[model samples]
Target: MKKLYSHSSFFIFCMLALLLFQSCYKLRGHYGGEQSFEATQRPVQPTDVALPKGYKMEAVATGLTYPTGVTFDDAGNVYVVEAGYSYGEIWTTPRLLKIEPNGQTTQVAAGEKNGPWLGVAYHDGAFFVAEGGTIEGGRILRITPDGEMTRLVENLPSFGDHHTNGPAVGNDGYIYFGQGTATNSGVVGPDNYDYGWLSRKPEFHDIPCEDIVLAGQNFESDNPLTPDSKDKATTGAFLPFGQASQAGQIIKGRIPCSGAVFRIPATGGEMELVAWGFRNPFGLAFSPEGRLFVTDNAYDTRGSRPGYGNGDWLWAVNSGTWYGWPDYSGGDALNTDDYQTNKEDPKFILAKHPAKPPRPVATLGVHSSSNGFSFSSSPAFGYEGQAFIAQFGDMAPEVGRIYGPVGYKVVRVDVKTGVITDFAVNKGKTNGPASQIGGGGIERPIDTEFDPSGQALYVVDFGIMPMTEKGPAPRQATGVLWKITSEGGN
Candidate 1:
């Protein structure tokens, strides 16, 4: 016999249906947006691809910290760098480790908090590491195979949100690294309007304000000097202003940072600028043909007005070229309107000035945060000359206060044809369900590298984000290392 449901029970059923419908709508909207593109399907369990047939994958290691960079030595030993928690703040652990083929791990170097160490490369029998800093900025550490370490370079401008990271050994034998700007979009003063010491308001007089102290201004602001005025500007000589007055221009820049790629001689010398105007280049690599390529994180517009989906990019880098940061992203040309308000336009006399034409080989998902990448030189991987890139998930919710999460897996790209296909999936029951969560998964894999045999690939999993009122402690173990190998077949 059929029974009538209670009023409360019927209401609850209706509410659940409405919630499910709303969720589907949101997912559809997200995938149907301008950033939508064809992505490779992921498998629930690790699956192998058809690679001529005999090659296989084996888990060499597991349970690692936030491993961001990996490389191999001539002796077949593997080296990995771990940035333990603290990240951008003043309390992260920076470590360099060596992993043997037998799964043995050894710590080579360690630093204090906020030391976001990333990017390691083996060259000329020595290992170089990129140590990211906050107040003191980033530095390149040189280490011998015997575990001896020394600071090769220091005092990089890392106070900005994005610091210097990612070091690569170029075919030219020079060590290249990236140094990011301190401010977002080149604001000349504090972002806030509060009259407190941290505000970005201009000074009442022209007596060398905040901008002069932190980042010196090449010229005076709107106010000028008169022969006999109460607050006259000093000519030729610079003078200090009150601490409160100086706060306005502390974060200013003559021309907002285009971001830069620099090279230091293998034998040690001053770092020379290679390319400029990149937003945050997290990955750099040279193809088998010796061409330079860079992976850049796109700009976020949620904090500012009239936001645009500038889009992340994969650029074929050339010396003296500009990739357009703070002004442009993707392949769009730079325009006057893109500049930050209240700032002067950069001088455009140089040949590379006014933004050089950019031609990206591939367009990563918007806000995907693509990091380390390596060319699949091993024929065992099946795709000879193909490139593998790691997506560090998205961080918009933490920084930009927006949500545009699409990529959470490794992508294989055909550099010549601009074609991208999903290469590997990090899905499992331990992470979350297989069902789509707003068209994306939750595993935040940050870096990828092929094993010495080239039959298997290693990926670093930087666990879940901490949600408690008090975040995870410094050096907390919340990271994992996963190995992906071919199970066999097309």
Candidate 2:
């Protein structure tokens, strides 16, 4: 086994080198898009990855292209979705696949240009998905087992840095999802160029679910829509490029708003707003007690607003409550030096608080990309009712600088006390990805789920997506799907 592992590693190394050489020769040093690399895949050594005793891990599927979420149907048939798009604007046909127990996979459905399909949930014999919709507007779709698809909602405001995400079905028979803001803070600016959407949809900006009175704060930056290299313009929250809102200006809010949570009938109908004021509410799951919990990505130290020194927030959501965005973090006001980065001092964009924002249950790492998660309900898995979140790790320099490697593992968070502890991480003296630490246990675990019986946990690994000065360089066919079954863990 050892000899076989070494031989496989050597082969991957050679292949990567050749691919890099070819890309450089063809692109003449362009780093974004037009370049494809393979993620180095070694055998999944259960012992090499640190997990609780009595729990064993196995790589059930490999060579997936940017997989985002994993789920299982009523009959215990496992399914996973390929995002079809990555941070660097690498777009392909998004797909849903069924994985057999032995790891063989078959395509179930294919999506259109509206991609980076963030997630899928199986409820009532149909698969519901949230399309990122970078090229077109975001949409919610339901797919039958035979591959017929229908649009439940369309023209959702997703032509921004973030897009439509989630569809976590609830006990109330509703499908809930998140719509992310177009800009980092409230204002859209040049920093959004990294997302590869601002240039395509210059008029696209965030829309509030309820009318908001602006503070009249306008951000000035190079207008991306204009051909002039230095044509500057001022932008404000809820307005397009070169548009500004005056003090106390009421921007009319509407349903299907950006930076909010929305729910629709399982059978498809009018979209209803659940809550608003999240910057990028990425992951949504329900606790055993029937409460919706969300993992929201914190404001980055980029963009025109550029707030600093705050980690991600995990909240037990309250219906119709405004969890502060563009103004607060972890229940603290952003209009203070605590959030001021070297480049910008953040200020509240709204004239008044919608209401005192509820504090997050727990805080995850900065730029950790604390995405898709699930609750462990099985008595055998331990930590029953606790969340198992996949920390996709940080995109440093591009997102911001980190003290050390922040999150590249799975963690369990206690809902009551807001305490977090490592459940699964790469085995190393120092924590990092396998590519950085010469290990192959795990890389960028994007989502987590348990089987219908709750006896096994499945993890989706969206493979190597390295950040460069140019932007994110996401590789293809480098993802992995892992399953962890427990005999009994206490």
Candidate 3:
């Protein structure tokens, strides 16, 4: 108790002096937000893609976050949408960038949440970006050339494991977009039995099932079931039992969200279904001749994780056609025996649908994750109708799903002949031991677009693995925007 008050006062005085000194030190430029890049010495060099002899590549702009989708206005200005981490991962924001023809890039919109702007298209003098959706789901956004953004459509179902994304402007003037399924396989019931259950478990569950299962039928009940009771008891299940019914029995069409293509009118109207039965359609485009093309990712499972034997495809999409999923892969549609059967429903259409009429226009290598494609509009390259696909490369290596030595490359597909050839390759090596490139290098070329002048092609490199285990510290900055100019062009 001896002079305790005085001792406390002395300590407080010392703390105040230290705080003042620290403030002064920060004000003296020792700290405080650091220095801007412009405040430092020279400007950072642009990151460019290395192209083959007939072509040159350069980075029109750098320092963008995760620039996934890129498009050009009719006036030749470049517009890029950034998926600020928020795709799948938490805390990611969204942004949009504008690049002038002279290579000056500026941020038009930033700090937007729930926007992994996966796809963008120019239509009707406005820029449309597919913001993978907000926390509420995916949406289509309209942005003016001056950076004003408006919501065109919202509440689109995108929360499924495989989300709704990838929007393109069709020749018909409608905006075409993708909606992906939630499950890997279109299996009915909780046990997740396949088509084989028909013969294997005829007594264990009802046999010879219909497509739509009645509700509440899977559960066992003691009472003799009445018609209304059976209907009320049937819950959507594998075998029609109790009140439960099979998937195809109750639902008129195939299961919802097995992946579908939709068209939205530019002037604002109801969204219409264009196609169904896709796994994950990442890119959509129309040929100069007005044919629709879509690149779909193959279904991946434990045995097919790396998708080595399975082939990805580019299809000439037709209206109301089914690009078989779970029921088929590559050009081979799985036999009906591969699926399960139930007793409650009859007339179950077997998994006998052809994926684009037994052939894809071109077959991309398995697990290539072929994404955003653009037909070359350039006259100099003489590739007016040729399509270029950005291959994200194979992710699984332990499964021996090797995609050649050149991992990250864009492939050019001959629309007429369905021939595929390497369009360009990234020179830098990848970091992983099994990585095709020696060192950690350019990765996951996500999207591509031709310059407004149609003289060059711009590719958006997502620049990192989509999934990473607890190993390795997370690489924070990994996205890049690259440009490839055709040979002999200015």
Report the backbone clash tally of model 2.
0
Give me the candidate number with maximum TM-score.
2
Candidate 1, residues 210-284: lDDT per residue as tens digits?
123322223222222223435423211122222222222333233212267777876687777787777677788
Off by over 4 Å in 2: 1-43
lDDT of 3: 0.58
Candidate 2 C-alpha lDDT tens digits along 416-443 = 9999999889898878666656577787
In order of lDDT, best first, we have: 2, 3, 1
Error of 1 at 231 (Å): 25
lDDT of 3 by residue, 188-253 (tens): 322212212212222222111113333222333322233354433322222332334443354434
lDDT score of residue 450 within candidate 1: 73
> Each model's RMSD to truth, in Å?
11.0, 9.3, 18.1
Ranking by TM-score: 2, 1, 3
Cα lDDT listed for each candidate: 0.56, 0.85, 0.58
Candidate 3 versus the native: TM-score?
A: 0.69
Better of 1 and 2 by lDDT: 2
TM-score of each: 0.70, 0.91, 0.69
Flag regions of model 3 displaced more than 4 Å: 1-50, 86-88, 100-104, 187-248, 252-258, 303-308, 335-358, 397-407, 428-441, 471-474
